[model samples]
Target: YGPRTERSKLPRVKVAEPATPEQIQETRRARAKAKTETPTLKIEHKVPAAERRCTVCGRTDLTTIGSGKSSFVNEYVSSQLVREEHVQEVLRCPCGSCVITAPGAPKVVGKGQYGASFLAHLAVAKCADHLPIYRIEKELARKGSPVARSTMNELLHRCATIVEPISKRLLDLICTRDVVLADETRLPMRNVPKGKSKTGFVWTFGAPDELGGVDIAYQFANSRSGATPRKLLEGTSGILLVDGYSGYNDIEKVSSRRRAACYAHVRRYFFDSLKTAPIAQEALDLVTALYRVEHEAKEARFDESSHL
Candidate 1:
């Protein structure tokens, strides 16, 4: 009875409504701004002559006024695979001494049926969109252009070969930057020995726009050993921000590279320990507060001294 009476006396906190007035006003302004900022092609619709007659007055003639009410509608255009045929012409002089022929059209894969635009779309679909080659084959079949999976794979390989030089240039540029973010993740290699799969690592290196926007480079290696990144970053001298992976220790020790631990990784450890250790919750809370302060500083575009 005592516990029940105490529980009853405890204060009941009510949950407030989801949105405040300021938030509602901000939402309205955001919608209006989106409408104004979005690029739109205005298409005017006119009333047909048959429907333009007035039903009440039985008048056959009608004219449009200053302006009509406007409404916006979203639309979509489906992607399609197009086929193009190029014809080369040959010419012969009247003397029959010489013959001239126009040069053949350029191809992504030399002497191959695919064009540069087709190869570009195929590469973007497979690499950037993460679409499987088998699925792309199915999609192409549905579009009345059935390209075999093996053929697509060959084309993709050829495209990679074509762009290898550009990729190398990007890597060189990234290595020259003063600061880089590095990480690695496991990738599975299919059809390994004994009909099994093998684990591979993809090492990613990135530099932001402030660091000259070198873009990101991905290097795949069979092993997650320290030597992989050490070799890739051989001549690079800069600060590397990475998670606490002992693989990077050798790079830091041997090269002119400074290693900085990722704060998000530290916070992740505290977050995982919260269930077992109550003190970890306090650390997590502090980290969350720090993130909030950082967010506010970024939103306000505060400089280093101002943030401090």
Candidate 2:
């Protein structure tokens, strides 16, 4: 036999109703704010005089009315590489004894040809979009600016060096928070030996505020050892919400932080045990009830004290 198969009914999920008039207007205002938040160069289009005339009456006279109807159209401007020529005007005294020149243009890297904007774009493409250097080079070539892959790699390293301080500052800010959540995931790294790879762990730390805003930081380590969390969260004291990992326990013992186990992990263990242990089903039912209560509290906008 290949395998056992069974058919069952799927659970139904509730669909949200359409927004009220007030909610719709609020959404429109928020969208307008988002649309205008960016710095944009606007180009206005005006109706030609001939086209503005009344077509049915064939009259050129038109009455000015209230502000004309308006709509917003989003457009993407393609990236183009431009050669910026900086001309510094040289000034000299009539006696020719002293001379001065305009200041030179600033660059992302000292004496480097690439501008700060270009370097920032490259960095965002590589890090945020996960584009390889070779792929980025091909894209630049298609845009009429063919740059060497090696040169792009060097520039990326230089950009990373410039951004390191800002990243450290963000990490420091996250550490100062009262509550933090952490997790780790495995990442494969190419090893020195040909056709070989090493498994590494990428630990993530997140600090979430009451307003649903979050700041996250990541640390990459070769091994998922207890010392990794200890080093990454050094000097940080708070409530850590994480899965039941032994490594975190070691950190909790050494630091002032307290470890709070994830309820989802407990639910998962009970769910898995249902296969062999029938009593696990009762635990699952209790967990479901707890979640339902939590959902009701959220829907009613209950605060911590109100829920208590």
Off by over 4 Å in 1: 1-49, 52-72, 89-92, 96-99, 211-214, 297-308
Which candidate number has the best TM-score? 2
Q: Please give, for residues 1-308, the per-residue lDDT of candidate 1 as tens digits.
A: 12321111112233233556886787788889987887788899988878888999989777777888898886775667777888889999999999999999887666889888888999999999999999999998998889999999999999899899998787767766778888898888785567988888988888765633348988788889988778877767889888999998887766688989987889778766766886776666676667666766654446555833
Q: Write the per-residue lDDT of candidate 2 for residues 35-103, one digit (tens) a residue.
A: 899667756677787698888998888886766666677788888789999999999999979999999
Quote the lDDT for 137 in model 2.
91
TM-score: model 2 vs. ground truth = 0.77
- Global Cα lDDT for candidate 2: 0.79
Shift in Å, residue 42, candidate 2 = 4.0
How far in Å is the alpha carbon of 163 misplaced in model 1? 1.4
lDDT of the candidates, in the order given: 0.78, 0.79
TM-score, one value per model: 0.76, 0.77
Which clashing pairs does model 1 show? none
